[model samples]
Target: MFDRKEMMEAFLCEANEELQKLEIEILALEQSGDSETSIKRIFRVAHTLKGSSAAMGFDEMKTLTHEMENVLDGIRQGRLRVSTELVNVLFACLDALNALRDDIEAEREAQTPTDRIVERLRAIGSGEAGAGGSAAGSGEPGHQGEGGGQAPFEVGEQDAAAIKQAEREGMQAYECLVKLADTCEMRLVRYYVVAERFNSGGQVIATIPELHMDLDVPELRFLVVSGLGEAELKAKIEQIMDVSKVSVARYALTEAPSSEPQIAVAAAAPEVRQAPGAAPVKEQEQKRSSQTIRVGVDRIENMMNLVGELVIDQTRITQLGHLLRDRYPVDENLEMLEQVANHFTRVIGELQESVMKTRMLPIGQLFNRFPRMMRDLSQNLNKDIHLIMEGEETELDRTVIEEIGDPLIHLLRNAIDHGIESKEARLASGKPLVGTVRMTAAHQENQVVLTVEDDGAGIDPERIKQSAVRKGLLTQQAADALTEQECIELVFMPGFSTASTISDVSGRGVGMDIVRNHIEKLNGLIDVQTKPGQGTTFIIKLPLTLAILRGLLVNLGPSTFALPMGSVVEIVRYSTRDIYTLKGQPVVKNRERVIPLLWLHDHFNLPRRKRTRDHVFVVVVGVAEKRIGLIVDELIGNQEIVVKSVGSYIGKIEGVSGATILGDGSVALILDVTGIFQLAGTPKKIGSAPDAE
Candidate 1:
């Protein structure tokens, strides 16, 4: 017996995928003029849903799908077509399906859901409550009369024979078993993959149930009509990673004539249509490959994790080697063993990196969705907007890509809502009616830079200052003293917004602050730039991946900290001459560039007794176009520190993004440079100060 919850989850998951496709296709059909084919596609989705619900004993879904199928048939036969009224009803049906789907997903929430819906159907001449292709929907009026609706005119004897003849002679058949790996990330995708494998082979034969059912099974079994033998089948299954195994069998989903190959046949009606409709059908099949074999993602990740353990083991063994070599100076083999161990260490390091790369998808995959979003938004707003996206191909850890979507969405909405001006205003200013927003990305040394710039109305620094003062986020005196750059950054301050009126979209000004906090949590930075009436641009600099970071290890007052390499420029020895106090703050001059220096001692609130040493080591950090020197006691040499932010409250005051096993085997804090910057530099206002009278 299968774990019932697992089976239900798998089924709901598959149904959801099909529903997504159906929604997209329906939307596309609305945009197209093809009513005949659209109805056909809709019917197919309904048929599949109907069969799956019946198999699962979901009576409500089965009834709903049945009603939907009838409506689709009415459209298919040219008696009805997609109208605004019909589409609205379809949307209602879609919503019902979605609600039902949600119930299946989390049945705990399905309290007294739609149990018994009204049944609507119409028959030809004789009205009866029987299944029919042209049955009316429950959402529609049910004509009250005898034999109002019936399933359909009964299939004639010749039509039934013709259907059997087509199945027996015209169609080919084969059995397909698609077994997913226990570690398969998405079982539905695996199902699609297996379907694609067979579809590429040739044709498919009959299968059980008059309708195709979407099973919520971990292992999807279907019979295909393919000419390929066992060898071809094995080769194809091996191609898809996470496909544990595939074993084909002879039996179809149902029993057929003994003289013909067994194939699944919808037992609902033995009748078939020899002349199928000529509507163009798209194949939603799975991916197929023949050379490579499948390996579970978990297995690979596990192997990489085990290698990490091996690294710790190697660290221990190396210590042992050093102790042994010192005790027995004449031992030649011990020294050689140390060298071999070092080699393995390098190999394991490279292997771990390679494994991580396997999970790295290009940022472009997420970025690609924005063009369509922009297109829709532009049309809806009746505003001419152009988006310039660059460096979208930059790759990041998949984990980062997933979380970044919503924040980016909020930013885009903010830009469209407040940053861009109306067409009339643009024309009055002699600018093009279409506003331009430029989004660029590129790797700088070790960090990824993403920028969103709009050429409409540049942000007003004075407005921000006024708002900041009003919100008590800043003192009026502080807002007055802020620079133009600092003014633009006020948006990052919680409860700080310059907009006077709120709209459906933005105006709350909370989004930018949230974006700032979220990125900071990821050890990333966000900044804004604007010139009044020219444009506004938000520049976000993020690490290559949240999973790994290159760090510079430093020591300050008995504590070790890691500075991200992407943020560091040069670690230089500085004398008191290089650093001078200006207005109570320490500043360092390097190559004629004044870099404000933050003392690690004072930053950490450690004991600040004056050091006798005159020379100080400074780590120069850069974010956006600004640079600052961080004062540390000494550089403990350069080492790669992987940043891991711990959340389960590990009980330590560890401020580092992650910890790494040092050659000396000690825990170190990976310095949050951006966090430290917030600790250090006074951010310049992001907008301009008012002009002096």
Candidate 2:
């Protein structure tokens, strides 16, 4: 017996892959009408899913895919045309398949009903609805055995001799015609079931269509040599699922003997019609699959954890070597120890990189899902949207990919519902009839930058200010005082929305705030830029991996806190005389920008470090366009740190993202820059500060 659980897992994996391919091809077929390649690919995917589902005993999936195969076969044969209505039905089938797949994945059996979708597919296949219009090949004849005709199969000379021999042995030859119901599902499976029953009592000499499963023949003709009576054979055929009529008659020699064997076969199965390049493609795919194996996410995560530990140990060893060299300045043994530690550090660094790469995956896996979503959303809104995606090959850590999806989804949804102008509005504005939403991802320095931009009516800062004030999120004076960029940032404020009405799509004053929150949790930044009449763009910058980061370690009295280097803008040493009071808030001047200064000691309830010099060290950290200067006791330089979760024992901290161990084995809290900015609230203006030079 096979491992049933493993079998299901494999099936689910393959099913998801096939479904994704089907969706892409179906979309292509819709876009490039009459694309034979897309049609054939779609048909092949449906056929594959049909066979696998039948083998796995997923009756619902088997039945649904069979109907899908039938419809696709009609389109492939050019008997049915591609149209918007037909494409909609195909998309509906895809949706149903996804629902069924989800059910199977969760419960180990599909519980979603596929009846409605199956009926629609059958109707389209049978030309009752959604056939659009017949194509050039509609005039061609269908299955010869399906219509009234003489027995569709003829026995060969060898079969004739065998039949005669069988008769002499008290057997009889019979011609069987089986007619399936028009609404029958999995007609080929039913045909095979009846054929199996016939073979039980005797032998099936030949089938009209050469017994190919890919053929969508509604009627079957068989020449059987058996001892069973005609009534027994007819009863067996009728017992099948969709067999409507059966005729079993004793065979008679209708022609004279021939010198050579004579047999009849219908046209070769549709599988032979595959594109000429398919073989090479299949060979390449086989080679690729042979070289790779699927490892579970948990296993990769465990490897990453081990690598992280090695990194920590490497750092500690390197630090200890430095300590030994400093204490024994001229010792030859310390030189050797330093060299060994250096080599060990290099190896550990390489190992860490390799492990991290294992957790990286192309963003295409997530981007591929959006086209279908855009199709549905555009249709629902009665708008025309062309979504262009680029840089799908850019890779990011799987953890980042997982966390980033929801935020991306929120942005895209808002792009459609709020950013993109309606068709009429676009026309009035002299823009193109169809709006464009472009999503792109690429590596910038050590981070991945993803942008979602729309060529729609851009955001208005004045409107945003008004909305902020109207929603009671800010006072009128406060709203008016914000700059254009700051006004645009109000979209990320909770309970702030400019939409006059609420709908299912958006306008609930929710998404943008959550998007910002999610990105910040990943230690990333989200910013927006817009022109009044042009468009809007949301840009997000995220680290390549969240497991480790370069941190700027700072001392707050006896405690040390690490600030992510990605958010560290710059460090400035300013004279104490430059400090001024801005509405009771301490402010410092860095270049020309007025930065509010915060005391970390006060925030964390630690003892304040008294200034020992005329100059004070100020670390400037930022989230998007907002910057704040953090006052610390001392600067400990920058180092690579492995981030560790704070755990449930301490629950959650306000300004701390997580904790990391320093080279000295002491734990340092990693400051959440975005959270610290939030804790500081809005900065006091420099124009309002007293003692300003």
Candidate 3:
């Protein structure tokens, strides 16, 4: 209630982060049967999200999280074990939470329809969730916890109602005594797990002081409540992973542990979830001081940029030392300079690596939402769609994460509307009724490649051809010459889409071109490949960060320019006699093919000096299918340049992507080889329209 607006925004950020953690835990838990800690971890996340959602006044979020909490409560109580189907459902729940969270953050003022979801959740809680079961049916096998060696509790009516209210306003006061079982794996983790379990149902009231370090007899103790009867609660507790036993006890004013689950702890203040302990709250006050601290990304980016400039300057200084050494040869002082320069290079290289790492954010930030997105979209379309995500640990520059969000959403919408088939269609196609879309990420050289692939009906070449002609992307004659793959790629052309009916989401190519544009702005590329009836896949390759481009510097028309070394095969010297004119175009033969050549003087409109030299530097470059030679005056060696975009308007200048200031303060434009090649009608991947994969 303290500054409601601020609290809402803070809650949104916290929930967003927690939701991401929840998704990773769920995926990890699904892959391992031994992952009890992971399972408990996911439950705790759901519990945290539930509290935050209710606090933020998101009714839809609150409702879904509430049910999600219940399912988690069942897991905590040991009423159910995770199954493949269960994980899918949990992912769906997480997906919903994510979308609701998104809408809130965007200030979209949108509400999701979740009435049926509530009914479904209720059924899940009552043991009637799957097909024909009902809440009134017999409980799951191994769900009972009436004996010792179990931290068990059952969900009774009174406890259920109390837990609900507690969730709405935060949990009321309670105390717990936790004793670690002999079978416990990772005691500290279990202690965390124990603490998390209590907090999930309701916040932790208090724990025995000096217990973790002291390991005293009362060393193992925790106090918690969820508004459910102790027996119902104990039933759930005893079933936790690695838990040898569980006992739900009440705490007296004297900090005594009550043996029976039949008793109730009196409620205290609004935020208080535990009864008053002998120790003050300060004793337990976030002992680790592990709280979130926010810093503007732009500031870090600025700092990183400055560091990059230092590297370039450092390199320049070493070059200066080399220049001085040549003139004043063979001296002990010059030898020492050489040694010092080498060390500087080593240190700077490491420093650059460290800075790059600081900019990396996990792809999990985005993957966390797909589970929820797939669920809602699938249900709305009356199809069964499975989203398989891989390489969730893949990292990207923070800026890439933020910029790529909208584009990824667009692709997901495309997969749902254009890639996936309905249940009936899938069944008729001799495929499983449940279609699948797999989103994967992997590191390829200095680039991060993300792919979105579907198993539904692939793009039809004829369909794309017709659509292209309809949208005027190509003339009928042009469309006629396009192979199936070529036709599918046309979907990326502006104003191209095949959907005759439009929904709130997709059917227009608003997002595809944008996806391509943004990726290119990051010096990335996108490619699309489809099978006539198999499905479509979009592959995107992006640089590690926009802050730097690994470039090979070369002299162009009395000035220097950086060509990304990642694409350069080699630099070969071509004598003027070896160069010939092919149909009025300058060409050079290197290895096999006659490479189309661009003269630095003519391309940049710079005055050319008389050719006193015997050779022209051939900067051999390739991007996708394009292999061309940039005829330059001299090669200036390779260096990683901190890429800085030239300001607006001029940025629109074809073939020049960005610029970086060199050691001597002169700015060199970074050549967009892909852009230049495309302009010169060379075969190469350009922008978002990727070559087929």
Candidate 4:
């Protein structure tokens, strides 16, 4: 016997996978209606789910899947054609399946009611529902009657043979139609009870829409092959509450020279028409090797923790070597120690790379879900949107991928709802009727850059300024003082929006701020670019991994700080004579570019060392396109540092991202480049100051 808990978990896992596949397949079918392979795939998934649910004794899931299988079977047989309404019903059933799966995970008895969705599926299958498909969904007199509504039910040669053999074994076969009251609640449960009654003494050979809940048609047909008489079956079904009617009919079965293989072949119908390209696609898929196994995230995280410890120890050992060399010069023992430290350093470096790779996952895992989401959103908003994705194979740390999904989703939705223009507006502007939103990800230096861009109406900074002033988020004077770029950046301010009215898709003004917060928390930054009549693009920059990074160690006064090398553009020395103030802010010219210069010690409230030299070392770092020059006392060179979070006691600091232990056994604050840029009040674009009035 199988462990019940293990079986349930396994079922849940497979069921969720099947449901997701069904969603993607259903969407594809809706787009390309002539794909025979997609229909067959959907049918097989539903059939397998039905069998699994039956085995697990999850009667509700089994019953709902039985209904889905009937519709899918009709589709596969070409009796029912694909339509928007049919695809919608299929999606509805998928949602119901998800709900049932969630209930199972919650340790509830799989009791999610699926009667309404089951009815809709049955109606679509029987031709009583859908646009221009049928109007008799209410089961009124004008609708096609039961005999003429659908193709006549016929037993395949294999089924006829089996029926004849059952008769020879002294079993009776009865066909019964059971109708229930239209107003009955918990109808699926009631149907399950009735199926159980027949299953007790006789086998339920088949059902019309296959023994689901009380459907919209108000009737169900069942075939039972058992020793129980027809009257007995009828009486048992009638005893089920809310069963309005039951009619039993006896049919004769004739079979001659039928073999098991013949029956099996007939029962398992071969695909009548295969898409021309499907065979090669299937062959290619099979040829591709699946050389991977699913590993739990916790296990990978544990491995990462061990690697992190190794890195810390390697740093300490290197520091010890420095101390030993300085104190015991020319000692053979110290020489051996140096050799061991060097070898250990190389070994640890290789170990860290291997462990980090294990934690790396392609960003495509998050990118693939957007197409379906965009399709649904476009339909909901009654707009035409074409979403294009590229560079999905770019890999990032699993932790970053997991946390980055929500922020990316917010950006995509914002692009669709606000950034992309409506179809009518697009045509009026001489643009394509179908607005396009493109998402791409790639490695930029040591960081992964993900962008969401659309070719629709760009942001109107004037509108944003006016909105800010009206919402009291900024005074009119402040709003008017903002440059075009600075006014657009107001979208990231909390509780600031430019929409005239609240909309379901956007206009809440909460999303952009949340997006920025989440990205900053992950040591990432979000930036936006807009043109007056073009469109908007949001660029997000994130490190490859959070566990370890190459950091440029810099000293301010007596304290040390680590700046992520991914954000460091270059290091330059500036003389005091070259530094000047514009609008009371320190600025410097580098290669004819005017860049803001900031003193780090002033922000951290640390006492600055009196400079004896006329020149100061400036580290030029940037987040997205905005660059800032950080003035520090000394350059301590670059090294790999293990990132550790500051204890919760102090929570978050203004410019500090996290803390990392250095080679000298001192904890250095890792500067959040994005935070510091924001702290410096740098404009998103250079020379973006408001024009003089």
Candidate 5:
């Protein structure tokens, strides 16, 4: 019943976790030179990955991890030191491991080459390159531990006590020396298998170099407290492949053998022991593991679909109850039906919320990936930049998290390449030598607002205007007429970039526009705020979840449409007298801001309804700084609507993002606020205008 596919998937998952931790710890180690804790963590992660890869028969991954483990072990034992070059080599190893993991996940085998990285790791581990600090102990495996002359298999007080307690329980303590074949390529893996065999029969008190230490030597010694006699233990060790010789001798507590050269104790036993009255860590871990299980994303999506169906049905039942009450006025069951509908509505609402919550994940998952990227970028650009992140605990829908990573990455790259000044320039400008780019996420009502701000040379509006004109994106007159904010907005224009030269990082003029498009596709908003000399901040606002949303349904002639409430700033009943022409376009004045008015009937090519009253309802919708007041014939009440994609048969509509089913079973197109703005074109003027109503 061995499930190879399932085992590979589990290995892939575990590898990803370990690799992420290694990257974080490696960066920390570089920051705080000679951090023992970070070194140990890095060593542990590499060792875990080495063991897992070996078990899965991924030779490439196992080899790479084994070399990485050696290098990390060297650093941990203080035989090697951390340096910039050493850190870069470690990062290279990490990148190789990631590629290997990706290959295994996709092709069921690691196709990435690890020979070069392994050589580099070996070079560093042997003190040949990029390695500093004392070059103690011949760099060979099983050399006496730090500050030589202590016994290699020496047991600590706690381990000796455990051995004595096991002896009292009728178990015999024995010293087992297992020697590997001279041609054994994976000595560590072979040792691991031997250790597992010992632990299966009885407890392994300890090992000579310890499990995580250097295991490249020909021989490994294990202190075992087992009920199995010497013959049984020797037979067990002989069964393992690549194990050349096995010798088991009864251990005497009184004497230190003079025949064997004494070596220092490397590390304590790997087994964790708990204090009195405390729950065992292994038991607690098992309890925790039992509490949670990995459920696939597809299952969650299916559940969400089912919830959407329930919501639709619930809406239908409530509508049916309203009809029953209104038409059949004092029927006996109408009251009960009404009560049941109300209760069902409550339950469905709760269910919808719960399902959406299941889809929610903290934004930190996305934010944590940026620091390492920032580090590499800063180094590449030769700029002194510090990236500060905040509000990572803010939660967003998993779907949103998946989509937002690319946009944020583009912004960070632009921040480093275009916004942040170089060290010399910063000094000349009287700013700090190290530029800081801060990324923060927070919950703003029903939306998640993320901002990436950089204290570099704030984007120059004049330069943007000039670039726009030079690139033929705009006429000189047009560019000159645009205000500073509008000039900055020009960056999002297709094929628009302010960089004088194109490079690998950016400057081909293909990033910002795509960033904006991706955000809009999620029904989100991205805006930029900049000052001349201070900094620039790109703010993105996205919905908490896309599966369900509160939508404002409106009537345009005989057709109904849903405007996402996230984009709907406010609804205003404007008097015909309040609407006037500003440069031949119908405009409305709301709170001193002039917003262009659009007729949905004209946009959708439907017949316009004549105004029968002096006032009109305008649903003001906006994304970022742009606002357009959409004129509707009638205002339908808001409701929770399930979003459904329009099938490919109908293709993509211009202003309609998607469609949602109503209580009456009719489909209403969900209006895309960003698309509507595009269809509306750029507004001409926003100044005071004469009322021509």
Candidate 6:
């Protein structure tokens, strides 16, 4: 017996893919309203969805997409032009389809009412909606004129030549019309039956309006240059189920046979037929390039877990090999162990790379949805903001991708709401009336840098300071003493809003702080840069993968800790003379900048060195725009370490992100740079580390 559950899952997967394509093509149509390619692309997706829904007995989905197909058909035939109203309605249809899909996936009845969207589509398809221009080909059944006994429709030059050559070869040409059942549930399948049945009898040279998956219409016209007589062709087609009638006519290529050929009056307009050998081979290759199979995400994640285990085992083997080398300096066994260890390392390295690649997906999957979002946002806010994206092909780990999506959305929304200025303001400022928000992703060393930039009114530090004071987030004196750069950084402070009036979009002062927190949780960093009249840019740096990271190992007395190498700037030897107290806080002047020097031992409750050395090490690290000097007893070299989470019983230790096992089989706690800053003090002021009491 067939697995009905498995089959339904397969259908849902395919349905989601088609829906994604539908969204992309609709956005393309909105941008390039004259693009026929995008129009046809959307039509094809809707047709596929309609056919599959009907096959699965999903009447609601089938009906919705069927109506969508009618509207797309009208657009394809040039009867309806792309308009803002049309785009909005299409977006509504897309949303409704997505809701239906969600219901199907959850095995629940679809509660979303699609009647309004269907009625709107019907109006546009039938030319009743003013948005739909003139009705060239009405979206109605039986609109396809008579074909048999009438002259065959005009064909392309190449096809015309092919038909004449076939006539000279003693083959008679007949135009056959196959009228399907008006209420046929599977018209696409029944139409395929007619095509297959007639093609088996004789070669089907050409078809009017071309054969496609859309079956909203009731009739089909095929021009067959074959040996079968007209009566035999009609009899064979009528035998197919619900094929109401079949008409056939013999045509001479030399002159008009009798009446004008059947002009396909259906929404699927008539097109000149191309000869058999006239199409480019690239078309077939293009179709083959897009062929793919869907796999469950759980399976991919399971594979990743197995690969992670192998990596841990590889680390242990290397450690064991090192111990043998140290113990047996002159033994031949050590050499053999080394060889096996090296080979194992090579194999595991390759295996790890392969598994990681599977988990790496192009960031385009997340970037593709933003265009439509910006479109709606622009209209709703009346800002006329244009979004530009770059480096969408940059790949990241799937876990990172999923975690970064919400933060990125928050940043984008904040950019549009706060960073970009209004049309009048931009014009007054001598800038373009339409603001531009550029979102770019690029790989920088072992990290991915995503930047969202906007060209509009730049952030004013004074306003930020005033806003901070008004919200009681900081004292007026504290806000006034902050440098312009520190003042601008106040946006990330909790409950900091610069907007004078609250709106539905933003001004709640909630987005940026949450965005910063979320990114920091993923072992990522977010920074902002703004110029007085020039615009603002938010740059986020995230690790390529979270499974493993390059960390700088440091020692505080006997306890070892791992500092993420991405945040470590440099290590400097500091003597007593190099450190001084400012406002009762340990401060260090490095490169003409005042930075706080915090002792790591105080935060972790670790012991400090009893005998103070003449010189101590200070590891300078930067998180976002804030710099801090970490006082350590010793500095260890950097190494690639696998990040393992701390157990749930001791969940979320302050100043500690996770733990990793070192090569010597000792667990080292990974330090969280952002958390360290938070533990010390706020962003505006860095207080002395707490005493270990």
Winner by TM-score: 5
- Candidate 5: C-alpha lDDT: 0.82
Candidate 6 residues lying further than 4 Å off, grouped into runs, are 135-293, 682-693
TM-score of each: 0.65, 0.78, 0.67, 0.74, 0.81, 0.79
lDDT of 4 by residue, 350-387 (tens): 98888788787777767767777887788898888888
* lDDT measured at residue 416 in model 4 versus the true structure, 0 to 100: 85
Summarize candidate 2's per-residue lDDT along 241-260 as a digit string, tens digits: 88899988887644421111
Give the better candidate number (4 or 6) by TM-score: 6
Tens-place lDDT per residue, model 1, 1-693, is 758776685467557655654665565555564454455566666776777778777887788778777666555443454554455456556667888887877775444345333233223112342322223343453322321221222222343444345334443344555567888767666666667767686543432222234544456555565555666766877789788777665432221111111111122333323334322222211211112222444565465556566666666676778888899989889868889888977886797677666555567656655654665576667788887788877876666776777778877877877788889898999999998877777877667788888887888888888888888888988888888888877788887677778866666757887887788766788888888999888878777666555667788878777777777878788776666666656676798887777755654565443467667777888766678777676677665444444556763342345566665667776776666666554433111111100
RMSD of 6: 10.7
Q: Which portions of model 3 show Cα errors greater than 4 Å?
A: 1-13, 21-43, 46-133, 136-143, 146-299, 421-429, 460-463, 477-488, 575-595, 600-603, 613-615, 649-651, 682-693
Please give the CA lDDT of all the candidate structures.
0.63, 0.81, 0.69, 0.77, 0.82, 0.79
Q: Compute the lDDT of residue 299 as modeled in candidate 5.
A: 81
Model 4, runs deviating above 4 Å: 131-290, 682-693
Clashes of 3: 40
Residue-level error in angstroms, candidate 4, position 581: 3.5
Candidates arranged by lDDT, highest first: 5, 2, 6, 4, 3, 1
lDDT of 5 by residue, 1-693 (tens): 649888877677678777878888889999998787677677667777877888888888888888887777777566787888788888898999999888888875567888888988888877787554444553533434322221235454477788867765567888888888999999999999998999898889888777774658778788898888899989989999999999888874532111111111223333434534447677744543112345567788898999999999999999999898889998998999989999999999898887787787778778878888999999999998888999977878888998989999999999999999988888999999999999999998999999999997898888989988999999998887898889999999999998878898998989999999999889898899998788999999998988899999999889999999888889999888888886678898899999988876765777767666888888998877788888888999899999999999999898888999999999999999988888777443222222332
Model 3 lDDT at residue 30: 68
Which pairs clash in the backbone of model 2?
Answer: none
Residue 687, model 4: lDDT of: 28
Q: Summarize candidate 6's per-residue lDDT along 101-161 as a digit string, tens digits.
A: 9999889888889888889889998889876565455453323345422222445446677
